[model samples]
Target: MIKHNVISVVLGGGKGSRLYPLTHQRSKPAVPIAGKYRLVDIPISNCLNSGYNRIFVLTQYNSASLNSHIKNTYNFSVFSKGFVEILAAEQTNEGERWYQGTADAVRHLQRYLQHHDYEHLLILSGDQLYQIDFQEMIEAHIETGAEISVATIPVNAKDATSFGILKSDEAGNITSFIEKPNSSLLPPWESEVNDEMKAVGRVYLASMGIYVFNKSILTQILEESEGVDFGKELLPEAIGRYKIHSYQYPGYWTDIGNIDSFFEANIGLTDDIPQFNLFDRNTIFSRARMLPPSKVSGTTLDNVVIADGCIVAAERIERSVIGIRSRIGVGSVIKTTYMMGSDFYQTLHEIEDARANGFPLVGVGENCYIENAILDKSCCIGDNVRITGGAHLADGDFDTHAIRDGIVVVKKRAILPAGTVIG
Candidate 1:
């Protein structure tokens, strides 16, 4: 039953300055997650799994890698009327400026969206990690006959202040919305609390940045309003004028807005029973690279996720997510770190040249101690290097690396000399 009358749009992300260095070369959506997949894959996979295939990913800053990944990964059969497409920002007679905000990105694409014969527009953020069936949300929207439905999740008071909070009436009709409200401004939970929620503790509703809007309503709001963002402007303005509702989602969802959250989200996957399951048969799709299985020689790994085509001769690896084509030399101890492996393996000649040039081959060198850090794709760490985030340094940006939330972030394709110490 192809009843989902929806066309999905994923906001590829803005400047992505919060996730610096990582976003230095690639867009936020292109940032590798779970060792193998990019952040954008989550929303696109969700749309596909929910039977909503006609999707558009809006991109602006540093989109080459993202565009390439999308092109190589998502190819629907000709017979299937489903296509995953990229809608890069462009200058038109209407405007020449880049995407101002989330809502502005969608509004500027109205020329294309107007032609699509869809009932609803499913808007999502590309940097979030979660799995949801949009069909269920759509059904709820249809049942309530709402002009717009904002997907929400229960968050504790501490985390609630970081998100757009909402209050609903008994019937799930959204009454008020506040964007990143302070502690004093947070409203009490209006809807009934479930037993599970009560047992966990007091929690408030936070907007997940996922929204469903009727096509006509979306068009009308964009046409009438000058607001650039939905949470900060459009949605709040529509609260009284339009029939807005809240769809509560009970699932594991995290907004990887910054380095701390991104690191925690990736490390959380190593849990015994992770909130987000990558092993589910329902696939979280990505660009399928033809590569051999990962090879580990005498390495003792615990609670680790090692992706394909990796050669690990490390002495010990604990609670880490290793990406594809990673080459870890002997005696290295990687602990609670995320090694986003290389884009491509170094050729024998390149390796030899690197060695001759006194640089480690495009991966971790022998006897390196990496802990509480993130090694971006193709990072070359020399032998005896120490990258521990125990110095309690909040943030610092240097030529070869950066410290974000105390975690050392070796920049993409950065080269650290032998015996380099970063603490």
Candidate 2:
């Protein structure tokens, strides 16, 4: 059942420089997660699960992969009015500059949005990892008679400094807002959270970068304000003018903003019960690939999430994620790593030719040891290659890989020659 009178706009973030080489060729939303799904799939899936299927993904930076992923993945029935469309930044009569910020992205796409019939607009960040019942949020908005609703989560003081903090009234109306406030100013910023959050020291309410706005108010704000951002400029200024309500969300949510957070989020899936439950009924939809099941030979695997079409002969793989079409040779020991795997399987003749010319294969080769690392898509790790990432190694960007926050990221399609060693 499609939810009527609502449209969702997913903000595919800017250059994503913080994610570095991972964003070198693809947009942030196109970055793969959970071994099989791209980051964009999370929000799109959430919208679909919530019965809000009419989604517009706004992207400005490298969007080729994101476009392809969305095209192949989402297809509604011909009789249905549901569609997931991509609105890329284009040079039009209005302006040619790329998205200045989150609000600017939406502002640029106003013409497209105005054509659609919607009472409310659901704006979401494409880089966040969580599953939310947006229908519940919409129902809350109607119940409170709010012109704007911001989803907030209780975060501790340390984490509060990194987000836009809010102070809400006893009635749940937002009273004040601050953008990444200073620690010294946090004494009086606590909001009333559930006892569970208070017990864990999460007293401050932080914006989750999720929002719902009335159509008329959203249009009015865009037409009147020159603000380029939501958290920074628009929301702060619109506090008194709009009936903004705070919708407290108690769930597992994380912003995949940088490499360290990205690495930890993927590795955390190996836990007995992950915070972000992928095994639940809220299915995360992605491109359907007709690939064979993973085949392992003599490899002892523990707490690993291995995707389909993998051919693993590793000596042991522990606490890691092996993505689709991964090929691990015999005697390789992969630990605490995310191997993004190959885009396509190499033909038998091509593999033989590469071996004949002493070239590395598409995936991890024999006798290799990799830890605390992320091997991007289609990387060629040669035999006997050793990569150990830790605090001891100085951070640097090299031809084959880059080290950020003690995690070595082997660039996409990079070739690490045989006997290559790094620490």
Candidate 3:
């Protein structure tokens, strides 16, 4: 195990443009996941589990909900020194522009990082769903004495065009790199399921945006890379000047950057061999400790994952993930979906600020039924509503709330009145 002192800073400062409708009012990393948790939780939890405490989260667009969630849910006030802070874009020594790219975000925070005496600085994205034992990667980086050790996985050559495809030596030393190339040059590794994706099996030790940087080298790279990013600029220079290496992540990892991928990741969790490690008790992903047991009043569930403190009253839920303290009323049908409450309250009555800044109570309307669809966290619907298929609806017309991928995607805290047929 390569050993080095490290501090992790998550790059969550994007508009999360692809996750529209859902991200219309919030940042991508702040986007809810697994029913009751935010996408950012995956990385934050990893940091804690991996023995790193001090963290800084960078944010740019729709940061209100993201900031509030961090403040309310991730209460690290117990630790005086170990803290989590959000760094919004500001008029830095660099300029007064919003974060232009990945490299720029770190560039802007160079001074803040200078104050810390960490041997290494790990950079991660807040919008991914994976359980990475970063401690193991840190060990490998220290042992190799590499300037930059990227956490990578193998990918097919055909799909490598979309990423910085690496041609590494047998010793795991990266030799060449290509960013997002065409699939015609695909590699021979057993391609991961669904290789056609933007970053599927084309892995080939491609950057998972999980970088272990020598803190000293980072400052230098940032200075030299005036307008650089992890993918576009600094990596190329690092590979040429330093002993850049690759550490294969044999575990499950998914970058749910877009709509289809995001949907699949949610559905992916239900698989018998789930790619994520929700059951890894040793990990640091924090779930609220609730006292009351779940109350399934009259609900009929089959092949479902229901968390603690839930109340299912005569609802038919199948192949779904239900978060803690959520209420599903009677005669409702939920399938192949994820339902999580961001309120963190034991019951609707207990929630003082039910909307929590325009956020709605987490509930499925009585007698409402949905199939092959997703209801984002904290969304509520009225009774007798049907969400079937509408592959041909426009945004401003037909289906009113909001149009995402030709299918209506309701945002968090938005109420759907009774008898609403949202196709």
lDDT values of the candidates?
A: 0.91, 0.95, 0.72
Give stretches of model 3 more than 4 Å off.
Answer: 1-3, 73-80, 156-161, 184-203, 287-292, 342-362, 389-408
Q: TM-score for all predictions? A: 0.97, 0.98, 0.85
* Backbone clash tally (model 2): 0
- Give the per-residue lDDT digits (tens) of candidate 1, residues 1-423: 548788999999798999998998889999999999999999999999898999999999999999999999999898988888999999999889999999999998889977778999999999999999899999999999999999998887778878998889888999988898888866554345687875775468889999999998998999899999999999889988999999999888999999999999999899899989988877899998999999999999999999999999999999999999999999999999999999898889998898998978889999999999999999889999998895577689999999988899999889999999988
User: What lDDT does candidate 2 reach at residue 5?
Assistant: 83
Ten residues in sequence with the least summed lDDT for candidate 2: 1-10
Which candidate model has the greater lDDT, 1 or 2? Answer: 2
- The TM-score of predicted model 2 comes to 0.98
For all the candidates, what are their Cα RMSDs to the real structure? Answer: 1.4, 1.2, 4.8
392: Cα error in model 3, Å = 7.4
Residue 150 shift from truth in candidate 3, angstroms: 0.9
Estimate candidate 3's alpha-carbon lDDT, on a 0 to 1 scale. Answer: 0.72
Which stretch of 10 consecutive residues in model 1 shows the poorest summed lDDT? 184-193
Q: Ranking under TM-score, best-scoring first?
A: 2, 1, 3
Q: Which candidate wins on lDDT?
A: 2
